[model samples]
Target: MSIISMGTHLQLLIHPSRSPIPHRGSLLQVADHGVRGHRHVRAHIMAARKAIEGVSDELNAVASQNMDFAPARRRVRTAFLPVQQQLNHVLFKMAVPEIQMEERYEKSSRGVEIFWKSWRPGQGEPMKAALFFCHGYGDTCTFFFEGIAKIIAAAGYGVFAMDYPCFGLSEGLHGYIHSFDEMVDHVIEQYARIRGMEEVRGLPHFLLGQSMGGAVALKVNLKQPREWDGVVLVAPMCKIAEDVTPPALVLKALAIISNILPEAKLFPQKDLAELAFRIPQKRKMTAFNAISYSDQMRLRTAVELIKATHDIESQLEKVSSPLLILHGAADKVTDPQVSRFLYDKACSKDKTLKLYEESYHSILEGEPDDRILEVINDIILWLDSHSTLK
Candidate 1:
């Protein structure tokens, strides 16, 4: 019976006079054995302590070499671009007419740098209309929307998209949404800049939003009631579907934690790639989306998304733009029934709602090739009808 107390020296405490102590060995022998055991334990402990201290010193030296986070972020973006280009090439076929692309960086009112890109058909073709896109949560324009933009551009319309702050190659910590209002303001500011371009000045402008982007588009239209000629929402997150949101007790816990650890990625949510795409192969391709923020949901971002949806639902009547709401009937990400709710309650007289049976959230990108083309054709026809001189 020996107890080893670990400290500067290993102290072995032995009770030599316990009841029923007639054991296999004498008390002096036991004491001798305990002394040897403590010595062995002390030697191993000293060795481990030295090893840990050496590793700690090495880690500190490595960390000191790069204290600035910005350059590390840039390195990550550089690696991501090659993957983005490869995926873009596989997705956007050159068989479609020649489309000229322009990429640029601009600063938001809040001083966050945003990455933006646009596509337009070449060959001296005049732009019929401008389609500005807002990507969904954890999605970047460079990867998923590359093909969608090409399709819209080949259809004789100029396509534009902005990677929001903290998303894609944009500046700020990734997957952190400080405030939903700030996000809405940033989108409006970027699109307003695009709308002011000399080439697109008088052309009709349409806002295309997917999932979380839908909430942004709605808020933008609400902010400036008559600026947009039309708006397209794909599974707009008006309200979080009951099935996907956390339980009441859990949400209450999150609400409290958000105030203390706003940026902490403590919220647990499903990996959206599995839930958003229906096809198994297409779902697997999402693994290579290098610039996406696929980490655990951040506390502030998740709470803001919930708050934004609630706010959007309350003011659905104020959404005055000509609306085209497309939803997947089986979408578990955002409720299709909510799209029906928006169509029923929205004040827009030209609102149209199309529910694709058995489709998932990524209707334009993740659907079958035929379905993707069909969705694109529908969008083009809508834009063509609305863009005509009226």
Candidate 2:
């Protein structure tokens, strides 16, 4: 769908209808091998970041004008269109003609219609394998992975992803994950359908996950030991990072409150875009990602995430799929050490871990161009090696 522009100083250029496109990666110019070159690139990023902040402040001001909620939201979204449009253009330019995308809604076992998207080689191209993805908390499969999926598809593998219930366009109270088991069940129910499809069957299947998704991938493997060939986790949350969790007393208080008011959105949810994205301009651009859940973490969801991570930690030895874990050395959102924990404790005979130095939570999208690309290249090489017919 296209954003309808309005009359204003910030005019969002009109474009063709948009689909599942990735972020603007091609915008960054690769720096030459010199300190001066690196500094010049950094200066450009800083300047663009300043401009993005200015626009964001203006949009926030427009939103706070005492208008009704719906109207105000519409105004804010409209104002943010230019930044969004710019990003879309970058992804569109990076489009791979060989990778065809299809979007549809699948009715979950719980009866909620979950959004699903797939990218594979265009018609007549033989598929060698499939990559099924589970996204992180407060994140959707639609936006962030748009380009990442394309990268995998370009590597001769089909990629399929679903936005969990309540996240992205899926139906539920926004930002709520009622029960982590049910969440896993939803992924299982839909994924089974994909696996049984005539086109999808017989292909080597793997699970790819990020942040909390890494835990989901692990659970999916635990639930069905023989289903997947391998699992790839990027900064997986095998356990909650110490700093992000509330104190024990506070958590007990929240648990009590959660039972009384499960929908209460009182947790001090940090602005993830700021914490996750290391590149300044990329971090600022996150403000314009209209579908991302930027609201405070609901008590119920927070409790469930904490519980899920704990459960995953205990069951690490039960993990049987070959594993590849990628993490940012300095990630504060999900401790890199927990990934180390998975590597050490898992029973899988073939498991690998790669840590990117000085990176943040969103290693796939938020890292510097070279760093992120290097990470993706690592994943691609791993998948290629794994997909070879034995």
Candidate lDDT (C-alpha), each = 0.68, 0.67
Expressed as tens digits, the lDDT of each residue in 175-246 for candidate 1 is 678788988889889999999999989999999988778888888888988789999988787765444445
Candidate 1 Cα outliers beyond 4 Å, as residue runs: 1-74, 80-90, 242-253
lDDT tens readout by residue for model 2, 1-390: 011111221111111011111222123223323321232211011011112344566665553332212234335545655655557323323656677899887787667878788999878888889999998766667655877888778878899999788776676655677789999999988888998989899888999988777878888989988989899998876765444444567557656766655555444333345456787766655544555454445557767776776788789998978899998898765667888988999999998989989998778877777787789789888888888843
Error of 1 at 269 (Å): 2.8
lDDT of 2 at 236: 78
TM-score of 2: 0.77
Which regions of candidate 2 fall more than 4 Å away from where they truly are? 1-85, 88-95, 241-253, 272-274
